[model samples]
Target: MRWFMWAAVAGAVAAVVLAAVALMFAGGDPEPAGAGSAPAIPAATDAAVSEAAESQVTDAPSASPSSSPSVKPSPRPTLRPMDVIAGLHTTVRELVQDGQLKPDAGEDLTKRLKDAAEKLADGEVDKARDKLEEFGKKVAKLREENKLSSAGYQTLAAGLAQLAALLPSR
Candidate 1:
């Protein structure tokens, strides 16, 4: 037990010394990540005056003290419910054209999806989501009735699930 304690103390001291040395070598402070970022520290004291010759690509040319890029690519846009509905409409059309889905069923599904998209656009999110759920049930029924290929049904069902997921919850 005594030997174990001595070994642990020695290890802790060594770790502390190593960490201090690493921090010193890494520079006094590291830059923080976020919107309000400061200009990068110059590699050398004299390098700051020759920034134009450095050939470094900055986010943008700024006249301000802050060198951080102001405009980040609009935080990756998420699919809206209407967008999902449009995709479903296209999928239904494709399946119909490929003869994997019945023309009548495809037409009906397209109409339902169009209505759902319209409803969502009109601020009827819950109603649109309900319509989408019903549409999914209809797709399942097509599988049960053997009116659609398994693969086609799976694709359609997945699209419906995705669209439903995009809808805002009640």
Candidate 2:
């Protein structure tokens, strides 16, 4: 948890730095009052500098920050364990629907897992409560029955952990 907090702080700092650098490179023709901003000149020598900096902002709009090449969109979160679970759920569902996976308890279990993954992905915490609990039990049973490696179960458990991270405690 401490490590996560530190990482968050580091990420925020890095984002600020990158935003600053990107703004500097943009030279602020019409970016927001925050990013890509340059301190207003005294207005006396403005004409000369404006002309000098004019070429830099040609490709960028004089109003929209999105036009600025240096302005980056907000970063998307990387796919974590829950994301992996969603991908696996989608894959397994497709396979089962196509009759690739034999119909039986495995199909039912995979469907339940898929629903739980979907619920987790959708941030439907309450809706997924029972499903998540059942999925854990199912995964545990699979680990025991298949004699799967600790790592294999660890990966599945890691997905559950990611789900937990996304949810509010019951």
Candidate 3:
């Protein structure tokens, strides 16, 4: 009779230990004694394991920081007015080559950009600004006619506007 009682006590103790270990490993919240509720054990899903593995891989340190202060890259230098005009010319030529702009339209735009650059070089800022505005108007017309895609129109218009902004205000 005493051996039978001892066996029952041992079995009960083993069950309690197993439950505690499960709760610890399964990340479950253990219910308080006499709470009359069991701990909610999360099911070990493949997705959960995969997410944990991925997080560990991503969180692994790739490099150690140096004791020296970090240096930042320098800012890009601002473009000159002539450089902007030249860039606009190149952009127009490339668009024509890419079949995005018709040859005739490209030539007209290039001429305007070249003239503007020359005017800028001669200190005729207002004239250069006018030519850039003209180029923008032409781009808008092409967009309206559906000859230029919205993207193309936007690229050309933005370049023209930037060039104009670089010139002195009237």
lDDT agreement with native, every candidate: 0.68, 0.57, 0.68
Please report, as a residue range, the 10-residue window in candidate 2 with the lowest summed lDDT.
94-103
Model 3, span 1-170: residue lDDT tens: 64345435434544553454455447656554767976787888999999998888865578986699876656546557787677677767766766667888888888888887788788888887887778788888887886665555656655565555556667
Q: Candidate 3, 97: how far from true, in Å?
A: 1.2
Residue-by-residue lDDT tens digits, candidate 1, 2-106? 434543543454455345445544655433465477677656655665775577667797676758767544443455667767767876786677666799999
Clashing pairs in 1: none
RMSD of candidate 1 to the truth, in angstroms, is: 20.4
Tell me the number of clashing residue pairs for each predicted model: 0, 0, 0
Candidate 3 global lDDT: 0.68
Clash-forming residue pairs, model 2: none
The order of the candidates by lDDT, greatest first, is: 3, 1, 2
Give the poorly placed runs of model 1, Cα more than 4 Å off. Answer: 1-74
Mark the regions of model 3 whose C-alpha exceeds 4 Å error after superposition.
1-75
Candidate number that wins on TM-score, 1 or 2: 1
Clashes of 2: 0
True-vs-predicted CA distance for residue 78, candidate 1, Å: 2.1
